[model samples]
Target: MIEAQGLTKKYGDRTAVDGISFTVHPGRVTGFLGPNGAGKSTTMRMLLGLDRPTAGSVMVNGRSYADFPAPLREVGALLEARALHPGRSARDHLRWMAASNGIPVRRVDEVLDLVGLPDVAGQRVGGFSLGMGQRLGIAVALLGDPPVVVLDEPVNGLDPEGIRWVRTLTRTLAAEGRTVFLSSHLMSEMALTADHLVVIGRGRVLADCSMPDFIAEHAASYVRLRSPQQAEVAALLRRNGLEVTDVDGELHIQGRDAASVGELVGRQGLLLHELTLVRSSLEDAFMTLTAASVEYSARQQTPAGALR
Candidate 1:
C-alpha cells in the first residue's frame, strides 16, 4: 500500500504541491486525476524520492522509497515512457534495468512476453513506434514484479487494443493484491479501470473517494420524462415547483429522482412513453468540479471587432 500524509512540494517561490494526504490501498486500482499543471507529476516525483517534499511524508509500504534496500522490489513506477536509451534494444533495456536492481536476467524475457513485446525485443528502441515504446516502458516497470505500481499516462500513445490490454493488466495486478496507482487524463478509461479516485486541483486535494461516490456527489442526476401529453406534464411539473427543462419535446426534471417524477406524473394521469433517470458522467462531474481550478481557459472573442 502507498500512504501519503501532508505531502507538499515547492519550487523556489512557487508551491507545486500543497499539503495533501491520500492512501492507495492494496487490491484495487486508485486513479489519480487532475487537470494539466495540477502538481500530479511533482507529487509522483516526491513519492519516488526523485524530488524532496517541502513538508509531510510518503511511503510505499511503511517505509520511504529511499529506505528500501531494493526499491524496485517494493515499488515499480513508470513516469516517462521515453526515459530510455534509444540505441538499445527492448530486451537489452530491460536487461540493464534488472541488472541495476539485482533482478534476474530471465525476468527480462518474462516481462517482454508479458507486455506483448517479445516479437520486437531484439529491435532497437529508436525504431519502435509510440505504442511499442510504451509497452517497453511497462515491461521495465514490471521487471521486479513489485507489489506496488505507479503509472502516469500509461496509454498516452496506445491504440485501442493496447489501451484495452493496459486496462486488463492493471485490473489483474490489483486483483492479485498489488497496489495500483494510475494517473490519466482519459476519463472514459478511468471510469472503467479505477475503483477509487483521488482528484487534485491546483495542488490541493479536491476529492478522495470511491468512483460511484465521487460521481454521485459532484455530478447532477436528473429524471427524463417523455409523454404524449408533453405540454400538460411539463405544466404540471412546473406548477409543483420542480425545475423542468423541455428539450426536443421531452421534459427533463431536476432535483428529484425517477420514482418521485413517476409518481407525480401518475397522479396527474399523464400518459407517459418513457421515464428514465440519467446520471451525469464522470467527465461531466470532472468539468463541474475543476472549472475554477483550471489554470488556463480559452475565451471566445468577437470576430474582427464587428460587433459592439
Candidate 2:
C-alpha cells in the first residue's frame, strides 16, 4: 500500500501541494484526479522521491522509495514527462534498466512481448509514433513485475484497442494483489476503471471515497415528467416533500426515484407522456466540483437564439 501523510510542497512564493493525506490500498485501482495546475504532478513527484518535499513524507509499502535496493522490483511508475535516449532501441532500453537494478536480462524480452512490442523491439524509439512510445514506457514500468504501479495518463495517444488493453491490464494487476495508482483526464474511462477516487483542487484534497459515493454526492440526479396534467403532477410531488420545478411544460422532480414518482402520479390519475431519470455523469460532476478551483476560466458563448 502507498501512504501519504501531510504531504506538502512549496516553490518560492507559490505553494504547490498542501497538507494533503491519503492512502492507496492494495488489490484495487485508485484513481487520482484534479484540474490542471492543481499540484497533482508535484504530489506524484514527491511520492516517487523525484523531488524533495518541503514538508511531510510519502511511503510505498511502509518504506520510502529510495530505501529499496532494487527499486524497479518493488515499485513501478510511468510519469507524464518521459526521459529517454531517443536513438536507443526499445529492447535495449529495457535491458539497460534491467541491468542497473540487477534485474534479469531475459526479463527484457518478456516485458517487450507483454506490452505488444515484440515485433518492433529492435526499432529505435526516435522514429516511433506517440502511441508506440507510450507502450514502450509501460513496458519499462512492468519490466520488474513490481507490486506497486503508478501510471499517469497511461492511455494517452493510444487507440481504442490500446485503451481497452490498458484498462484490462490495470484491472488484472489489481486482481493480482498489486497496488495500482492511476491518474487520467478521461472521466468516462476512469469511471469504468477505478474502484476508488482521490480528487484534488487547488493543491488540497477535495474528496477521497469509493467511486459510487463520489458520484452520488457530487453529481445531481432528477426525474423528468412530461404530462398533460403537469401542474397537478408537480403539485402532487411537492406535497410529498419532493422538490419540483416546472420547465417548458414539464415537471422536474428531486428527492424521489422515477419509479416512486410514477407510482404516486398514477395513483393521482395523472396521464403521463414521459417519465425519465437523468443523472449527471462523472465529467459533469467533476466540472461542477472544480469550477471555483480552476485557475483559468473561459465564459462559454452560445450561438444567438440557441436558448429559448
Candidate 3:
C-alpha cells in the first residue's frame, strides 16, 4: 500500500537517508526497525510529505501522498504525539480536526471509543498522562479510518499495559486488511507485532524480509556442548575446523549441527555431560548485522585518567 523509490534526504553535507527503498503491503503489519540515528524518523517525514526528499519519492496507494484529494482519509499517521491541543478537551480537539477535514463529528466519538478514551473525552489533554496522550493521538489517526496507518514509536513512553494495547490494536488493524507501517526500536515487541520487517542502518536498507526468514538467515543455529573434559573437546572440535568457544565452562560449537557433534563425540569416546542446540536470538543477529554500521559506539576504556 506504500512504496518508496530510492528515497533520499540530505542536510548540508550529511545524508540523513541515503537512497533507500522499501514497501509496505496490506493484510499485515510491516515494521521499520533501526538503531538510534538511523534515519527512521527522517524517512517517515519524507513519506508523510512533511519533509521534502532531496531525491526520489514516496507513494501511498500508487499516488504521491500530496496528490491525495483528502490526505487524512487516505493516509493516517501519528508521527509523534503532536495531534493534540494542550488546552482543549480530547473531545473538542478531535471535533475540530474532524470538522476541518470534512469528517463527521460522530467519527470523533467513535474513534475515541475505539481507542478506549471515551471515558476521558471531556478531560483536557494537558492533564493526560503519556499513555493517555498516545491513546488520544491514536484516536485522531483512526478518526478518518484511513486504509494506511503509519505510526512512529507509538509506545515510546507507554506502560506495559499500554504497549500491549497498541500491539493488539496493530494486529487487529492488519487483520482487517489495513496497511500498518510502524517504526520502533523494540525488537522483541516487533517480533511479536510484525510479520514483516525492514531493517535500516546508517541510513541504508540492511535487511527486508519476512520475520521468520530474517531470523533464520541472519541468526545462526549452533550446537552447544559441555563436558568435564572441556579442553579435549575444544581441541577436537577445532581440529575438525569448527569454531568453538568456551564460555562459563561450556563449549559452544558453531558451523555444525547436533547430529554431527554427537557423532564426533561418540566416536572419540568423550564423556558428554550436556549437549544441545542453541539458536541465536534476533537481538544478537541484529547487533551482529549493524555492529559495523553503528555511528557512535561507546568506548570500553578512556584515556588514562590524566595519570591521576
Q: For candidate 1, lDDT tens digit of each residue in 73-187?
A: 8899899999888999999888888888899999999999999999999999998888898998898788899999999999989999999999999999999999999999999
Model 1 — TM-score against the truth?
0.93
Query: Model 3: per-residue lDDT, tens digit, 1-308?
Result: 99999999999999989999999999999999888889999999988989999999899999998887678888889987855668999999999888878898889989998888889999899999888888888888888899999999899778898899999999999999999999888888888899998989989999999988888888887888888888988899899999998888888889789889989978999889888998776787788788877888987775798558
**Runs in model 2 with CA error above 4 Å?**
247-250, 302-308
| Cα TM-score per model | 0.93, 0.93, 0.89
Give the candidates in order of lDDT, highest first. Answer: 1, 2, 3
List pairs with backbone clashes in candidate 2: none
Q: Give the worst 10-residue stretch by lDDT in candidate 2.
A: 77-86
Query: Candidate 3 — which residues are off by over 4 angstroms?
Result: 239-241, 263-271, 301-308
1-308: candidate 2 lDDT, tens digit per residue:
99999999999989899999999999999999999999888988998889999999999999999899999999999995256888999989999999989999999999888889999999988888889999989998898899999999999999999999999999999999999999999999999999999999999999999988888889889999999888888788888999998888878888989999999999988899999999878888888889988988888998889976
What lDDT does each candidate get?
A: 0.93, 0.92, 0.89
For model 2, what is the alpha-carbon lDDT of residue 84? 82
Candidate with more favorable, higher TM-score: 1 or 3: 1
